[model samples]
Target: MQDNLYDCPEYPLLLILSGPSGVGKDTVARMLIERRPDSFYFVVTATTRPPRDNERDGLDYFFVNFDEFAHMIETNELLEYAIVYNDYKGIPKQQIRDALASGRDVILRVDVQGAATVRHLIPNAISVFLTTRTEGGLVRRLHQRKQDTQEGMALRTATARQEMKRLAEFDYCVVNPEGRPEVAVERVLSIIDAAHCRTHQEPVRL
Candidate 1:
């Protein structure tokens, strides 16, 4: 029985990537998945927001009109959903179910609030919080974005300060240095690898 504990079978892990508004969570998630293409199921989030210049409808997010997104909410089809910057962002339950059922780890990139919600929904999920090296760096990154208005940027920066205090709720934290996404990706990859090596793992609920 003692030896059996060490022989635990590998199960598909549910890895969540979350962070402050301007912390590059999307960039790090994309890089990490591309690093190990065969090992992850990236859950594409559904959003009612318009697609950006470099964003693809289905790839970056399943861009839909408000009615379509609202329907998903009405049907309880989303794992988690939120109103962000006047836009609806959510994760589809079906994608995560299909991915885990097929024996692949799942990755979800969400904001800090969504992360906390996911923790309750999936207690065993391996949640990692990513942030910049300093507050000044984070503020600069937010300011550099083109689409957000001055008011919107100020709101995000304020929310980020509140979100930072919740880091203790996560399993691990990685600071992504300015302009250094590779470093963040490597840190997150290592955390996932370590989780799989644990003798007792939390079973992902969703």
Candidate 2:
């Protein structure tokens, strides 16, 4: 066994979590924040979608309208942004930078496309791909949300199938089978622990 295993010294680490919609990405992220509130900072994404009931500004998302989103795109303020389900969603560079500089383990719950963009920008970032054991499970979870119509659910399922193909591109894959949110959270936490022990240069602060 290797001796003197490096202890991650409260340095900033960016953990990019991506997966198909309804694969429990948000659920896993929420658990992490709740379990280790001091150790991790959940990065809030900016979106053009109207906030749903019970969703608060700067919590669930940084809600914005179309015009503001378009202006952000024009100014290149977003590190990565994409139109998903006809709504603009993106990570703001300044928010990420600030979080990193503060030596917080910043976790981003983003789509596969946004994850890919983060990988390109921060090559050493830990990328975790969340997945469901089967397509049926994905469909079921989407339906449980009751936020989407039948047609919307169908579109999400179709999109999920396409996103699943990118699994190989991630560093690790965790299956949130049967919506076991705790299991998924543990798997991701294990990956984060393992990553901290690797012998690599410290990640760029922000």
Candidate 3:
């Protein structure tokens, strides 16, 4: 019926790209979407945290107040949500459903805790854990960010160390070295390609 194996239709994928705070999850997510804009849909997360000077409300994150976030939770509109570094963040359900319905691979950039919750909810979703090449590298990145106060930075560093121990929970561990995010993006693309070619692919349950 088909001309060749390449002609077979492939199912869309739900990919969770997660890591500790400073491992470049956002960078890698942006690169993936840039590389496959038509086939990939990046899920913008909604957060109760105040936006930074350079961040936009709908583009970088759906910046919401505590009341709005609570409303979303009450209405069961979020797919998975968690408090991170004293701020609430969540993935919206309808945007993901719409993207998957349109056959675009959905990508979610979340922290390690949120990733675990999403994996439990969507067992068939592919989860990738991103980390720097060395623990010291991660620490340096966290320190260099300077977005947080000294106490806040200390807390984030401690939390990141704890999150690193969660590497086993993910399907793949990617080393996103500093300033070389493109390499990590290439590896992620390869993973997506391999997933599409699996002989016994499990339909993502969402």
TM-score for each of the candidates: 0.94, 0.91, 0.95
Report the lDDT tens digits of candidate 1 across residue range 55-133: 9988899999999998999999999999988899999999999988888899999998888889899888999999888
Write the residue-wise lDDT of candidate 2 on 30-105 in tens digits.
9999988888889899999998897899988999999998898899898889889999998988887888777778
- The residue pairs in collision within model 1 are none
Per-model tally of clashing residue pairs:
0, 0, 0
Each candidate: what lDDT? 0.89, 0.87, 0.92
Ranking by TM-score: 3, 1, 2
Ranked candidates (lDDT, high to low): 3, 1, 2
Q: Please give the lDDT score at residue 64 for candidate 1.
A: 96
Whose TM-score is greatest here?
A: 3
TM-score of 1: 0.94
Model 3 spans > 4 angstroms off:
1-9
